[model samples]
Target: MKRILAVLLVMALLMSCVSLAVAEEKKSLTVWIPQYQFSKAEDAISDQDFWDGVFDKFEEENNCEVKVEIVGWGVYGDTFFTSLLNEDGPDVVYVTDNYDLVKRDLLLGLDPYLTDEQKDNYILWSTAPENAAGEKVIVPMDDGVAIGYVNTDILAEAGYDELPLEWDAFIEAGKIIQEKTGKRAFLQNWGATSGTSALMLAFWPYYFQAGGKMLDENGQISINNEAGLKTVEFLKKLFDEGIFDEDIVTESESVDKFANGEVAYIVADLNKGNTTFTPAGVNWQYVFSLKGDAGFGARTATDSFAVNKKTLERGNDELAVKALVYITSGEVMDAFHSQIFYLPPYTKDASFVKDEALYALTSAHSDAIYVVEEFEAKKSFEDTLLANIQDMFQGNLTPQEVLDETMEYYNTQLKEE
Candidate 1:
């Protein structure tokens, strides 16, 4: 009986050893990337192939295993924040939402991992910010502008051999196309009903071109002045003349509509056009200029990757940073923007004949807004501005009244926050 009991104990110990050995063979670093990224390919298998082609090399060179988790944009922020409390969270996170995570002290500071030479790789000196603790947490991977797109087929249908360069000509062309083809002629890339996301990029450029300031040296809302009023009036004009759709809300996108030939012209940056219009094999070209009372210009936008602070304590922070540096550096970055359909900010000029005109207008941004990015306060400002603008459109308020409300709401929120 003693011998029988001893044998059973030895058997149990052997089983546990085998399980431990199997787990040891597959330890891996986890990375979370947005689902839509690298999804330009037709199907899931092809998309996976594209990712594997790039990541497999890194895995081999580093001799470390990795697990790539494709996170969806819809629930990415919610899931990431919840999962971050776990010690086994992803080593790197890509952020498209607000930089709230950084301000909240969630992400790892990348300053320690980066070198001056690597910083010089970008054309602009945007790497460093005064808020080194807060703003300098991201490694910028994608940057672009919002500009115009023209369908050659639509232009020809409108009886034009060349695209228009000024706002008046552009609107006139839109009218001709709508009258001739019985289709909507123009659409802004953004939905008008949403918050400041689209308006900031689509309209702010024009405001700046007209020498309108969005904020003052004291950080006061300055768009209520001449520039702000003119912009509001211009938007109203577009609505009144039916040149722009009044019903465009946060859910609408002009690119998808443009691809179906419902729209003759649109406002989309090179990257957005590249991914949507180019892939659909639409007869399109970028006719970027649409000058207002001021001049032609566009606003630049960016998306970036941030490291996880807990990964540093895990002793794999170096590997995580290396992965980030490689992903955003040289060949990867060039290929990313090229395939994704936007020019790198460092590209000397809009010399690429294929998309020259678009870049020519957007590449040299005239009025870049360096507004204070207090996340909660900015959200409050945009919400109030959106409501006031809606009231102005509904005849419940005047542009001046809207502007006054905007300033009051923003200042109050700024102080409260």
Candidate 2:
């Protein structure tokens, strides 16, 4: 009887240990990414497998399971904000742009989570504060810039072997292309009298080209100068000349035109041609922005990822930071750059890119790629300006009217804020 009782007690202890082990195995993590990253069927499949492998590796090393949930772009921002404010939010979330996140106080400062050496490995601008708080909120995963992709073959057929250097030359070339090919010379986004992403992409290079200041140092809206007016008028002229697509007011229409071989040249993200257009058999070459009278250069927006402060408060801060590091590490960035066909933020070296075509394209235009650091400061005005410019393109408002109205509305909004 004594032996049997001892054996029963030992069995009970063994069962309790097994139960504890099962509970530990159930530990899980959740990560959120935008739907666009997984939009294509191939992208969806590859991303799932890639992330699964990454998570599995982490789990094997740390003894925890991970769950990745992709959220749609339309509702991603709102959903992420709401989730971050919740008690049971995701362990990690992808941030599109760091400046926007910092402005809204939606991101957690990652300084505590990283060692000095670890932080040093990242690009310098990635860690710089866009706000006065000096909080480095985001880690850049993948980055891309707006560039002019000209169909050299079409340009040559239109009677030009080299691209124009000045705005006048560019417009003239556009006319020649249109006259010769009976296709649009340029493609733009002109839909709805409200600035769309496509229009913003085209407008920035011109603004820089014209030597216009979009915002003041103190972050005040300030695009009412002569250069600004000239820039707007030039774009309006392009529209009046029929150099740009008639339906450019809509987002993706211009890109569609370029992809369909209906336009000789289009302002686009480099990835559009490198990945999407090339695979569809559209042969295009990248070029620097056409120089303006002031010889101003090109500028492009930067996208990044940030941590949620609320998530940090939930006791997995270290793990969350580790996950962020893993995502932004050079190895992961190279993979993302190759897969997404975007410029890598950490390294500008062509040797870093694995894709032959992409390497050559990026290398060719490397000297012209300029990072816009004032993006966070000018976010509000830039948003307003883009909408107003779109309206200008649609002829709902004249160039002057758009500029004046945008300035008035922006100043009013700033005062209210």
Each candidate's TM vs. the true structure? 0.76, 0.85
Residue-level lDDT tens digits of model 1 in 96-197: 544456546777777667777776665443732213354366665545556677888878888888877566676677778888988888776444554656
TM-score attained by model 2? 0.85
lDDT by residue (tens digit), candidate 2, 1-417: 999999999999999999998886655667887643433644443565666766777777766677877677774656876786677878778865455557667677887678877877765445355434675777655446577778776888888887786888888888888899888777766553434353356676777778776657875557788778888888888888778655655645777778888778877765687556776687788775677876745665555666666665666667777877776776666665555445644633223554466556555765555555534335456567777777777768888887898788766664454
| Ten contiguous residues with the weakest lDDT in model 1 | 345-354
Say which candidate scores most in lDDT: 2
Clash totals for all candidate models: 0, 7
Query: Highest TM-score among the candidates is held by which one?
Result: 2
Name the lDDT of candidate 1.
0.64
Q: By summed lDDT, which 10 consecutive residues of candidate 2 come out lowest?
A: 347-356
Error of 2 at 13 (Å): 2.8
Model 2 ranges off by over 4 Å: 5-9, 14-28, 36-44, 97-100, 124-132, 192-196, 294-296, 339-352, 356-387, 394-396
